[model samples]
Target chain A: MKELDPLLHSQLRLAIVSLLLTVEEADFVWLKEKTEATSGNLSVQLDKLSEAGYISVRKEIVGKKPRTTCSLTPKGRDALNEYVRTLKEYLHI
Target chain B: MKTDELTEKESIELISRMIEKTRNEMNGDDFNSFLAYGYAAVAISIAVWLLTHFTGNDMWCFGWFAMFIPYLLSFFKKGKPEVVTYMDRMMDSVWKVIGSMFGISLLIIVVAGAISGIIDFSMMMPLSIIYAGIGTSITGLIINEKWFVWTPLAGLAAAIWMLTCGWTGGSYDNSWNLLFAASFLIYMVLPAHIVRHKISRS
Candidate 1:
């Protein structure tokens, strides 16, 4: 069984998920810019989230340019909510 | 160990925590400064409008005066970085929408001006400025930023009125230049004071 606490543990992945929660969908460049993470690092983190079935990645052409967009899955949203609830509980806020 | 080595879940959790912490630490000082600058620009513009309306002199002078107050205030009141950063995010989003609309409007004006070569290139500068004021005001309303509703309304109204009067040779009587001036005062200066008070309180 995967631990809920483990899902709440990493910083870069946490940033990516939090940003995706606010925006409907974000492009790779946008997420990279907002999080100030390098391309290689963000790519690795995104793959991990995709593997966990927490996010969906789509590649499409925008203005004749190939773009990759990432959106939070239902599972991602639920996991995020649970993580937030637990954090609040821990902080007693 | 490395900053870049966090797991996916761990990354998500860490960012969530950072945002939460950042929001908790937010104070009203930065918001206050933003409002202050906004209002001061507005108030001064309104005062200029009244002066130009009654005295029948050049309104553009007053308009320029009104626009300068916010720039001055921003220079003086440099607040905390966190609050500033948050406010920047909020305002930048607001401004971006306004900017996009303003760009569209400018395209309209440019096409119109080009077709009617009677309108000089120099005129585009003032027209763009006035349209930007109007765009920002409307954007404010859309975003529920009540502090910004007045300046653009005043500007748009003034612009429409001036354009109409110029075309028909009505009350303004070809004094479209003065009306543009008056619009700036009403739109830019008048709102500045209101924004300033709102910011100071918050």
Candidate 2:
């Protein structure tokens, strides 16, 4: 069995990647709403994903407000797919 | 649900839940563009039918130009997408392709009218309905829109019936316009009720 990536083994980060995989890109606010995560926690997890180069984060100002958006990088997608494959193997389904 | 740690089974469940949640967000403006184009097309189809049926003049068929109403209205329909889903782009592309087809069909009708001094949209009408069906069917599949999965097949059946009537001598003088009117009711307005139900519940 392939070992899961430690970086994505946590709950919030994996949830973020899963959401990003489904969307083209997601703003920070939307991610918070979906994950029901505190702003502080979501931001920290997002930073970890960004540092892993698993997801790309873009910050810009819109209407005098800072807006942060996240999208899965190609590496992120590969990691997620491999993770699922490994889980399937473990589940023996 | 957000959390710090998870077992393998829990991770799998998290992925499933997150994907499902995002799919729900695929609503993307409650399908504003679809409803806008659908309603406009239905209204215009009825208008063309009314004008042609009552006037008994081919010139009245010019109301087909009114189908462009949705294209113009698109600029005014506003909804900001917070998270852009892949379906949003696919939905946009499907309508764009159908709009181009509508443009090409209009060009053909205009050229034909200019040459003959009368617009006879015999085949064009059915073709337009077929195009409408294609757009909705693609959209329905992308968004998990239930009505779309089957409505397009119904619309296609209607269009084919129109073609059969038009090709043979069985169709009335301009009653296909009324047939168009009825088909648009199915193609466009029916989805409105479904959307309305969702909005009220939500």
Candidate 3:
């Protein structure tokens, strides 16, 4: 049986990635709102995903405010697809 | 649910929940911006009709320019959405094209009138109503909003009905103005209001 990607097996990281799958990109505030993650925790989690090359993070100044946006990379998407396949396999169809 | 880690079943479930949540959020984006334009289209059509019919002055038909009011209001709408979904981008791009087409059609009318100097605007209203209907119906299909599909179809049908049966005389007939207004009312205003009401209730 295939194994789930450890990076995506966690609840919050999986939630963040799952949300990004349906969108082109999402910003920090939006993700925080949807995931109900604390700013500090969300930032740390996002850093891990970015470090893994599973997601891309961009920071820019918009209207005198710092804005951070995240999008799932193609690598991340493939990992997600693989994770779901593994889950399905473990369940035996 | 736990903040981290999940069983196999839980992982699957969480993914499903997040996807569903994103879809719901797409629907939850306020349709008020669209509704503003829809109602404006209906209102301007009627006002143009009334003014032309009563004053016997075709120049009053230019009142349709007031559509810029809602267009500008929506253009300057403040703040960014928390998340911009694929659906959001798609819908925004679609409407931008439709609005551009509407503008291009106006350019056609203006250029045609400028060369001739008569400025007969009889075709502009009905054509624009059809464009609105197309945009509304397409959006309904993309978002799976049933009323959005049906209402615009009804509007398109009304527009066709008017084109064939509603017109009484020639090119300058005043009835076109009223028909233009009524079709937009059916195509855009009615469905928008209905969907918004349902969204609010739910």
Using DockQ as the yardstick, the better of models 2 and 3 is 3
- Candidate 1 error regions (>4 Å): A9-79, A82-93, B1-20, B24-117, B120-130, B169-178, B189-193
Model 2 chain A worst lDDT window (10 residues) = A60-69
The whole-model C-alpha lDDT of candidate 2 against the native structure comes to 0.80
| Rank order (by TM-score, best first) | 3, 2, 1
lDDT of 2 at B47: 73
lDDT of each: 0.59, 0.80, 0.82
- Most accurate candidate by TM-score: 3
What DockQ does candidate 2 score?
Answer: 0.64
In model 3, what is the error at residue A6, expressed in angstroms? Answer: 2.4
Task: Residues B150-202, candidate 1: write the lDDT tens digits.
Answer: 65666566666655654575543324444555554555444555554665676
lDDT of 2 by residue, B96-185 (tens): 898899889878888989999976666677888899888877777776777776777777877888878767876534666676766666
Across residues A1-93, which tens digit of lDDT does each residue of candidate 3 receive? 667899999999999999999988889998898888899889999999999999999998877789999999999999999999999998877
Cα miss at B161, model 2 (Å)? 4.7
lDDT of 2 at A60: 88
Interface RMSD of 3: 1.7
Native-referenced TM-scores of chain A, all candidate models: 0.88, 0.97, 0.97
Q: Where does candidate 3 clash, by residue pair?
A: none
Worst 10 residues of 1 chain B by lDDT: B78-87
